[model samples]
Target: MGSLIDRVGIVTGSGRGIGKAIAEAMLHEGAKVVISDMNEELVKQTADELKQKGGQVLGLVCNVTVTESIEKMVETVVNSWGRIDILVNNAGITRDALFMRMTEEQWQAVIDTNLSSAFKVTKPVVKVMSKQREGRIINIASTSGVHGNFGQANYAAAKAGLVGFTKTIALEYASRNITCNAVAPGFIDTAMTQALSQDVVTKILDKVPLGRMGTPDDIAKAVLFFAGPGAYVTGQVLEVNGGLYT
Candidate 1:
């Protein structure tokens, strides 16, 4: 049996990228996973693809920004699995702009989608987890949140807020045996970063002592450590960058 055999996990915004990689890692460890995304087609496609690999999986449409949607998601998972053992708040979007060029809409959208969504989803999930007195909550943060990035004022603020939220939630739930932590990735080779021009990417890589961009799997490995049976760590941010930001 896998390490997480019989465990039930839900990963939001898991249709693709780092989120999807996290879900896949958990599945390999013997956990049943719910793959959630706002895009219906993406959810279905990812769910089906993962299931084909012999993992127990479910796909759900979840808009983490909406409280009602989050509540329903928690309810559905609880009803199906009888308990939730893990929650990953991985759904987020980027609205890149300098402070002067950034619109109120851009700021609000990023905050709501990145920071607020974690709160909405975690609130209901925490109720069940608190009762069981056993759970893991991992938030996907970014290095941009740690060190301010160019043309990413909104994204940085939202992700930085997530780090604070992670700490508070960890402190509040520690007594309940639910640990919360954040994984801050830097210059991962995701679709978003791949779109950058070579010159831009080159400049970004020059700062990294390792001289390479991290992969989704690199971030996934860090998350799996937190989810594992041996991790006593919580309320901390693990930087998955290749020595880019200290």
Candidate 2:
């Protein structure tokens, strides 16, 4: 039997990229997953695709920056599945600029989506999990958060905030049998990194001893460890960085 057979999970920003990979991994392990994203069409498409693979999937349109939208999604999930066994706070965006050049809007946007959304989404989910006495929460953080990046002050701050949030949740909710952890992915080959100039990409790759960009599946594998076999683990940030020490 799969490790997460019959479990219900929510993966935010799951319409594509790393978030999609996490959802796919959970579904492969027999979890009923919720494909939550702001893009309605993408959500529907991804859910349909996963369902075709025999996954028990639900598609929900969620604006992670809006608490009302978040609450509605949580309500719908609970109404359909009766309980939430896992949540992956994977919704994030990068507004790349040096600190001096970054605007308030860019910083606020990243902070709201990446860090504050976790606070909003987890509150209600935690209430549900507290009653069930078990749940797993994995936040998608970044290596930029750990070591900082030149053009990602806003993104790095938000992710660093997420790392703190994960640890705090882990400590506060352990008594309720809920585990919270953060997965810090480094240089994953997603559309985000693909947007970079070749010169920048080559410079970044030169720092990696592995000499290659990490794939979304590499991050997914680390997430799966927390969701499945790593039951005794919590409050930790696992860096899946392809041996690239910043």
Candidate 3:
């Protein structure tokens, strides 16, 4: 994909799962990538592996909930590379519990990780993007944001907020060449989902007409579309479910 040739990118929570896949895909497309995660060791290992494959890669620890961490990560990217072209806000957490029994900390933790983190990272990128007047941003949302799930009020609210945030950013940057959009994934086979009870997976599968869960690659490819081909597409939420909602 020469379209993304020589582009620079950042993928948050890229130590593993869908984030890792997106980082890999971006590298395959000839883009230099910055992989950020809370796990310094994992990010370092993953970045090293990608580098072994001759990809331009940088790894760093970044807690998206902290503005300083976000700023440091971006600074590291600029110092290592020279610019930022694409950004994927994929870092998120889950503190699932029934609302009736959920504590304030539980609800706040999910929102902070899923939604506030987006604001933290995107804040710096926006300035850089606005200065350059060209950029691509993809926020990794979830199906829960669209169709609420049981015991995921916080996650759902955060994901839905991402959709709204994306739309607003798109409008704000429309005059420039920047595009902001969201990719809402459903039932992806990641570490987190794999840990779910088999019965839970089965119950979820029953709702999906596609008869199978999505893969990290599925989400990665969608991210690639937004970062490259979907330049004209912005302020939209592309649900990457296996026909779960439809």
Q: List TM-scores for all candidates, in order.
A: 0.97, 0.98, 0.97
* Candidate 3 per-residue lDDT over residues 1-246, each given as its tens digit: 456888999999999999999999999999999988999898999999999999988889999999998999888888888789999999988888888988999999998999999988999988888888889999999999999999898889999999999999999997989999999999999987987899989999999998999999999999999999446898999999989993
lDDT of each: 0.93, 0.93, 0.91
Q: Give the TM-score of candidate 3.
A: 0.97
| Model 1: per-residue Cα lDDT over 1-246, one tens digit each | 677898899999999999999999999999999999999999999999999999999899999999988888889999999999999999988877789999999999999999999989999999999999999999999999999899899999999999999999999999999999999999999877877889989999999998889988999899989988768999999989999983
Q: After superposition, how far is residue 79 of candidate 3 from its true place, in Å?
A: 2.0
Clashes of each: 0, 0, 0
Top candidate when judged by TM-score against the true structure: 2
Q: What does each candidate score in C-alpha RMSD? A: 1.1, 0.9, 1.1
Identify the superior model by lDDT, candidate 2 or candidate 3: 2
The segments of candidate 3 whose C-alpha lies over 4 angstroms from its true place after superposition are none
Judge candidate 1 at residue 74 and give its lDDT.
88
Write one digit per residue (lDDT tens) for candidate 2, span 16-115. 9999999999999999999999999999999999999999999999999899999999999999999999999999998898888989999999999899
The candidate that wins on lDDT is 2
Q: By summed lDDT, which 10 consecutive residues of candidate 1 come out lowest?
A: 188-197
